[model samples]
Structures are given as C-alpha cells and as structure tokens.
Target chain A: MSGTWINLLIDIIISLSLLTGTFFIFSASIGMLRFPDIYIRLHAVTKGSTLGIAGIMIGAFLFLYVEHGIVSGKLILGMIFVMVTSPISGHMISRAGYHNGVKLWDKSVRDDYAEAVKEKRKSIDN
Target chain B: MNLQIVINIIIALMWMFLSESYTFSTFLVGYLLGILLLFVLQRFIPDSFYMDRVIKVIKLIILFIKELTLSNIEIVKLVYKPKLDFEPGIFALPTELKSNWEITILANLISLTPGTLSIAVSEDNSKIYIHAIDIPDVVESINDIKETFEKAIMEVTR
Candidate 1:
C-alpha cells in the first residue's frame, strides 16, 4: 500500500515536470517565430531550448530513479552534453551571421564594431 | 591535468566493485564516483588544487544554469510582446583570461545567455567581440559579464 502511494507521488512529480518542460519548449518555438532578427532569434532558441530540455531530462531522470532504483549515468551525461554544446553551436551561428554582414534591425541603437572597423581602416590608410 | 585523469580512472574502477559490474558502465560510475570522492577528499588532501578546480567547474555549471534561466525568461517576455524593441549592437569586450579554452568557455557562456552572442575574437585575443540584443549602456553590460562569468572563470582556471 505504501509502495503504491510512493509510486503515485512519483507519477505526479513526473507529470508536473513534463508539463512544465513542454510549456518552455512551446514558448521557445513561439519566440523563434516572433523575434525580429537572427541574433535575437538565436537567443530564444539556445536558452529556452536548453532549459526546456533540462526540465524534460530531469523529469525522466526522476521517474527512472524512483521507478527502477537505477541511477542511469547516461541520462545525466546526456544532459551535461546538451547543456555544454547548445551554447557553442549558438555562438558559431551568431558569429557566422555577423561575419556574413547580416543586417541588424533598423532600430538597433549601436554599431560599435562597424565604427571600430572603419577606424582601423583609416589608421592603416594614413 | 594528468593527476586528475589518474584519480578519475581509479575512482571509476572502484565504482565497478561497488556496483558489481565491469564494463562501460563502470567508467560512467567511476566518473561520478570520482567527482563525489574528490569533493570529499579535497578537504583532507592538502594542496590538492586538482579537486579544487573540479569543484570550481561544478560551481561554474551551477552559475551557468541560474543565468540561463534568467535569460530564458527575458527572451520569453520579449518574444511574447507585440513588438521587439531591444537595443542591439556588436561591441568589443576586453578579456584578461588568456587560455584558448578559457576564452572559448567565456564566449559560449555569453552566446548561451539571452541577449548576448559572441561574434569574434580579436587577432591578439585581447578582446572578445559580442553582439548583444540589449546594450543600452556599454559599461553596464561589460561589468555584468565581468562580474558574473569572467570572475568565476578566472577563479577556476587562471
């Protein structure tokens, strides 16, 4: 009887985490569609997706731990890998976008890089 | 680095005994077990900067998680709004951290956050070029990165 109660508790926890994870992921996709530019959109994709995936992984991990009593190191390692890699990929894309001269939004308040480049060019020409 | 790897492997082998299994699973168990054991052993093992660095790396991971969450919320709000009105710009941030690995980690951390994306590293590696969605004030943004990420990184590696 007590085992059943404990299982029910685990089920509820898992469901709650799953729901929350799904919501974050939903928010991420929505953000991707709505954001104005590549850099900003990249932000939405990386941070939201990382945390959303984290939530799902945590839920799955908890369920596995409670149900099987087997602490799967693979799941934890997978989570760590995801957490580490997403940012690196995001960095690569954003850097490439910038290097390719992807135009910033019209309302973008600053262009420090452009100004810096021009200054270097002037100094070299002199 | 050599000592750390050696300790990690021994811990992994010990894990094989505890779990009563010897396979790839032992390696995984060893890695985790090494972390836990090193964490405890650090207190007794005088001058063991090896475990200290591992612990610091773990702290960095925790810090990254907290910042990641905050940035996610910020991005979500911006997305949910009717119009995106952030002040975006690419600026150069001077970094004191020298190592290639340290610089890479710093860049990744910035890119992972909501508003900032690392664009380039200067030829001299003295500055990291970042494109941020909101840079209303240059000094404020620079200080934020220095205080939160760079400071912790300096403690860990440099």
Candidate 2:
C-alpha cells in the first residue's frame, strides 16, 4: 500500500516537471516569433530552450530511474552537452551577423562594438 | 590529479569486493570512505586534494543553474509583455581573465545568462562584445557580470 502511494507521488512529480518543461519550450517559440531582431531572437532560443531541455531531461531521468531501477548516464550526458554547446552556437551566429552588418533594431541605444572597431582601424592606419 | 582519482576508484572497488556487493550504494559508501582517508592524510599529499577542485566545480555549476533559471523567467516575462519597449544594444565588457580557456568559459557563461549574448571577443582577448535584449543601465549590468560570473570563475580556476 505504501509502495503504491510512493509510486503515485513519483508519477505526479514527473508529470509536473514535464509540464513545466513543455511550457518553457512553448515560451521560447513564442519569444522567437515576437522578438524584433535576430540578436534578440537568439536570446530567446538559446536561454529558454536550454533551460527547457534541462527540465525535460530531469523529468525523463527520474521516470527512467523510478520505473526501471537503473540509472541512465546518457540522459545526464545529453543535458550537459546541450548546456555546453547552445551558447557556443548562439555566439557564432550573432558574431557572424554582426560582422556581416545585419542591422540592429532601430531603437537600439548603443553600438560600442562598432566604435571599438573604428578605433582599431584608425590606430592601424596611423 | 589523475593519480588521486585512480586511488579513490581503487579504494572504492576494493570496498565493493570485500563486501561482496557490487551495488552503487556500496561503491558510494566506499568512495566517501576513501575521501575521508585522503582528507585525514592531507599532510603528506603532494599538492591540494582533488576533492577541493571537484567541490569548486560543483559550486560553479550550481551557480550557473541558478542564474540560468532566474534569467529564463525574466525573458519569459519580457516576451509575454504587451509592448516591447526595452533598449537593446551591443556593448564592450573588459575582462580580467588572462587564459584563453578561462576567457572562453566566461564568454559562454555570459551568453547563457540574463539578457546578454556574447557576440564577439576582441583580437587581443581583452574585451567581449555583448548584445543585450534590455540594458537599463550599462554600468550596473557590467558590474553584475563582474560580481557574479567572473568572481565565481575566479574562485574555481584560481
């Protein structure tokens, strides 16, 4: 009887985490659509999706562990891989966009990078 | 560092074999015992114990997770807002991290947190160009990064 109750509790916890993870991913998609520019959209996709995936992975890990009584190393590894690589890819895309002169949103208040580049060029020429 | 890990693992395996149980809990108990043994004999160890670095690395991971969750909520709120009137811009942040790998980790951490994305690193590696979704105060944002991520990283590496 007690074992059945514990199992039911684990199921509830798993479902709650899975629901929260799905919500985060949904928010990422909405933010991607609504964000004004490529750079801002990257923020939504990278940060939101990273955390979203982490939540989902945690849920999956717990489910597998409780049901099968075995630890899944791959789930933990995949979580770490996503956490490490997402930012690198985001950085690459944004860096390329900036160098390619993709315009920022019209209301962007500063462009310190451009000024830094200009200063470097002037020093090289002099 | 590698030697310490190997010794610890050997100790764990010996414990499992002697107990005649190959379960994870048995291994974990043995590992803890090994750590205790190492801690008690730290005076003769060549350098700092590997567990010190392991604990620091774990602390850094926890800090990153906390920051990631907080910033994700902030992004969600910004996204669901009716109007997107926040200021977004690219700004330069000077970094005190000297090593290449350290700088890379810092940039990756910065990209993963808050409203900021690390767009580029300077040729000399002195500065990182970050593009932010919202920047109410530039100095405050810079200081925030310096205090949290940079400080935590310094603790881990140095």
Candidate 3:
C-alpha cells in the first residue's frame, strides 16, 4: 500500500518537471518570434532551452531510476553536454552578427563595445 | 590529486574483492572509508586532500544552477508580457580573470544566466562584450557579475 503511494508521488514529481520544461521551451519559441533583434533572440534560445533541457533530463532520469531501477548515464551526460554547448553556439552567432554590422534595436540604451573599439582605433592611430 | 584518487579507487576495489560483493553500495562504503583513512594520514601526504577541490567544484555547479533557474523564470515573464519594454544593448565588461579557460567558463556562465549574453572577448582578454536584454545601469550589472560568477569561479580555480 505504501509502495503505491511512493510510486504515485514519483510520477507526480516527474510530470510536474516535464510540464515545466515544456513551458520554458514554449516561452523560448515565443521570444524568438517576438524579440526585436538577433542578440535578444539568442538570449531566449540559449538560457530558456538550456534550462528546459535540464528539467526534462532530470525528470527522465528520476523516472527511469524509480520505475526500472536502471541508472542511465546518458541522460545526465546529455544534459551536461547541452548546457555547455548551447551558450557557446549562442555567443558565436551573436558575435558574428555584431561584427557584420547587424543593427541593434533602435531603442537600445547603449553600445559601450562600439565606443571601446573606436577608442582603441584612435589610440593606435596616434 | 591524481595519486589520491588512485589510492581511493584501489581501496574501494580491495574492499569489493575481500567482501565478495561487487555492488555499487559496497564500493561507495569503501570509498568513504578510504577518505577517512586519507584524512587520518594527512600529515604524511605531499598535497592537500582531493575532496576540498571536489566540494568547491560542486558548490560552483550549484550556484550556476540556481542562477539559471532564477533567470529562466525572468525570461518566461518577459516573453509573456503584453507589451515589450526592454532596452537591449552591448556593453564592455572588464574582467580580472587571466587564463583562457577561466574566462571561457565565466563567459559561458554569463550567457547561461539572465539578461546577459557574452558576445566577444577583447584582444588582450581583458574585457567581454555582453549583450543584455535590458540594462538600466551598466555599472550595477558589471558589479553583479564580478561579485557572483567571478568570485565563485576564483574560489574553485584558485
């Protein structure tokens, strides 16, 4: 009787986590469609998706461990791999866009990077 | 560090063989015993215990996950807002990290967290160009990075 209760609890936790993960991924998709520029979109894709994947992986790992008593190493490793790589790809894409003169949203508050580059060029010229 | 791990593994294996139980629980118990033995014999060891570094690394990972979850919630709120009202911009953040790997980790952590995404590192590796989804004050943002991510990383690496 107690075992059934434990199983139900585990199932509830797993479903909650899976739903949370799907919500984050859905928000990321909305941000991609709604954000004004490339850099902002990268933020949505990288952070949202990374956390989403982590949530999903944790839920899966727990489900497998509790139900089948099988410790799958791949789920944990895959989560880590995605967390490490997602930001890197996002960084690269934004960096490329910036260098190629992709315009920021017109309402952007500042661009210290551009000013820093200009200052460096002036110092070199002198 | 390497020697300590080797000793620990050997102790675990010896315990498994002697007890005729090759299960993971037995190996874990043996590993804890090995750690205790090493702690008692610390005076004879050449270097510090490996567990200190492991604990610090684990702490760093915990901090990263905490920040990731908090920021993800913030992003979800922003995405659902009826009218977008954010000031996205690129700013240069000067960093104190010297080595390439440390800087890379710092940048990756920044990108994974809320509001900020690292776009580029300057030639001398002194500054990272960060694009933020919103920036009311650049100085405050810079200090936030320095205090949280930079300090945590220095604790682990140094």
Candidate 4:
C-alpha cells in the first residue's frame, strides 16, 4: 500500500520536472526567434536552455533514485559539464559578435566599447 | 595527484568493497561520502584551505540557482510582452578580483545571469565590459553585480 503511494508521488515529481523543463526550453525557442539582435538571442539561449537542461537532468536523477534506487554518475557529470561550458561559449560568441562590428539595437543607450575601439584605431593609424 | 582527490578515491574504493558492488552507483555514493567525510575532517586541520572554499562555492552555486530561476521568469515575461521595454547598453565595470581564474568565473557568472553578458576585459585587466539588456540605472546594475557575484566570488577565491 505504502509502496503504491510512494510510486505515485515519484511519478508526479518526474512529470512535473519534465513539464517545467519543456516549458523553459520552449520559452528559449520563442526567445531566439523573437529577440531583436544576436546578443539578446544569445542571452535567451544561455539562461533558458541551461536551466531547462538542468530541470530535465534533475527529473531523470530523481526518477532513477526513487524507482530503481540507482544514482547515475554520467548524469551528474553531464549536468556539471553543461553548467560549466554553456557560459563560456556564450561569452566567446558575444565577444566575437562585438569585435566583428555587430551593431547594437537602435534602442541601445550606451556603448563604451565603441569609444575604446575608436581610440585604438586612432593610435594604430597615427 | 592532490590529497583531496587521493582521499576521495580511497574512500570510493572502500565504498565499492563494502557494498560488494564495483558499479557506477557505488562510486557515485562513495564520491559523495568522501566529500562529506573530507568536509568534516577539514574543520579539524588548520592547514585545510579547501573546506572553506568548498562551502563558499556551494553557497555561490545556490545563489546562482536562485538568480537563474528569477531571471528565467523575467526573460519569459519580456519575451511574451507586446513591446520590449529595455534600456540596453554596454558599460565597463571595474573589478577587484585579481586572479585570472577569479575573473573568468566572475565573467561567466555575469554572462549566465539575467539580461547581462560579459563582453571583454579592459587592456589593463581591471575592468569587465558588460552588455546589459536593461539598464535603467547603470550604477545600480554595477552595484548589484559587485554586491552579489563579486563578493560571492571573492569568498571563494580569496
């Protein structure tokens, strides 16, 4: 009897986690399509998808722990790797975008890098 | 190589033997148990620099999780809104973190958080240039970074 109750509880948790994960990933997709510029789209994917993947992994881990009583080293390691690497790739992409002269949106208010780039260019031309 | 890794491996082996199962599950449990044992032991050893750093890193991880959830909701709202109301800008924030690893961690944390990206460092390596999606007040955002991530990072690095 208690076993059945525990099984039901685990089922609820797994579904909830999976649903939340899917929602976040969906939001990331919408954001990628809707955002105005490359940088903003980058932000959407970096945060939304990372958290979405985390949610999915958490659900899988919990399901395994509850049902099979087996913890997965690979899942844990994969989560750690994703968390560590996503931001790095995001940083590199944005840095490259900036250096390649991608313009900010018209609504952008300030850009200190523009002045810095001009200063460097002036020095090189002199 | 390091004492910590060596100690963890020893503990993991002990777990494998004790469980009579040299499987991945045993190793995972053993690794976690080893961490807990090391955490407890580090308190007694005066030379243990790792325990405090580990605790601070865990704290920072919690902070990042909380911030990520909040920012994810914020971005969702922004994405679905009829019109985006953002004051996007690029600003330079001077950082006190001196080490390359520390700066890298800080930059990564900023890039992972809400509506902000760490674009580059100054030539002098003293300032981090950030692209902010919404900057109603630049000083306020800078202070927010300093108070949360910079301070949390300093706790781990120093």
Backbone clashes per model, in order? 1, 0, 0, 0
lDDT of 4 by residue, B56-88 (tens): 889999887787787788778778888987888
Residue B125 of candidate 3: its Cα lDDT? 98
Q: lDDT of model 1 at residue B100?
A: 94
Q: Model 2 chain B: which ten-residue window has the lowest total lDDT?
A: B137-146
lDDT of 1 by residue, A2-107 (tens): 9999899989989998887888899989988887788778878888887788779889899889988978888778878888998888777876886687888787
Better of 1 and 2 by DockQ: 2
> Could you give candidate 3's fraction of true interface contacts?
0.88
| Candidates sorted on lDDT, descending | 2, 3, 4, 1
Predict model 2's lDDT versus the native.
0.88
Q: Evaluated with lDDT, which candidate comes out highest?
A: 2
lDDT of 2 by residue, A7-126 (tens): 999999999988888988999999999999999999998989888898899899999999988899899899889988999999999988877889999999988899877777899999
Assess the local accuracy of residue A51 in candidate 3 as a C-alpha lDDT between 0 and 100: 82
Q: Once superposed on the true structure, which residue ranges of model 2 sit more than 4 Å away at CA? A: A68-70, A119-126, B16-27
TM-score of chain B of each: 0.71, 0.89, 0.91, 0.73
Docking class of 3: medium
For each candidate, the alpha-carbon lDDT, in order, equals: 0.79, 0.88, 0.88, 0.83
lDDT of 4 at B106: 86
RMSD of each: 4.5, 2.4, 2.4, 3.7
Residue A29 error, candidate 1, Å: 1.3
lDDT of 2 by residue, B1-158 (tens): 78888888999999999999999999999999999988898888777898988898999898888878887998899889999999999988888888988899899888877788899999899999999877776447668766678788888888
Please give the C-alpha DockQ score of model 3: 0.79
Q: What is the lDDT of residue B116 in candidate 2?
A: 87
Largest DockQ belongs to which candidate?
2
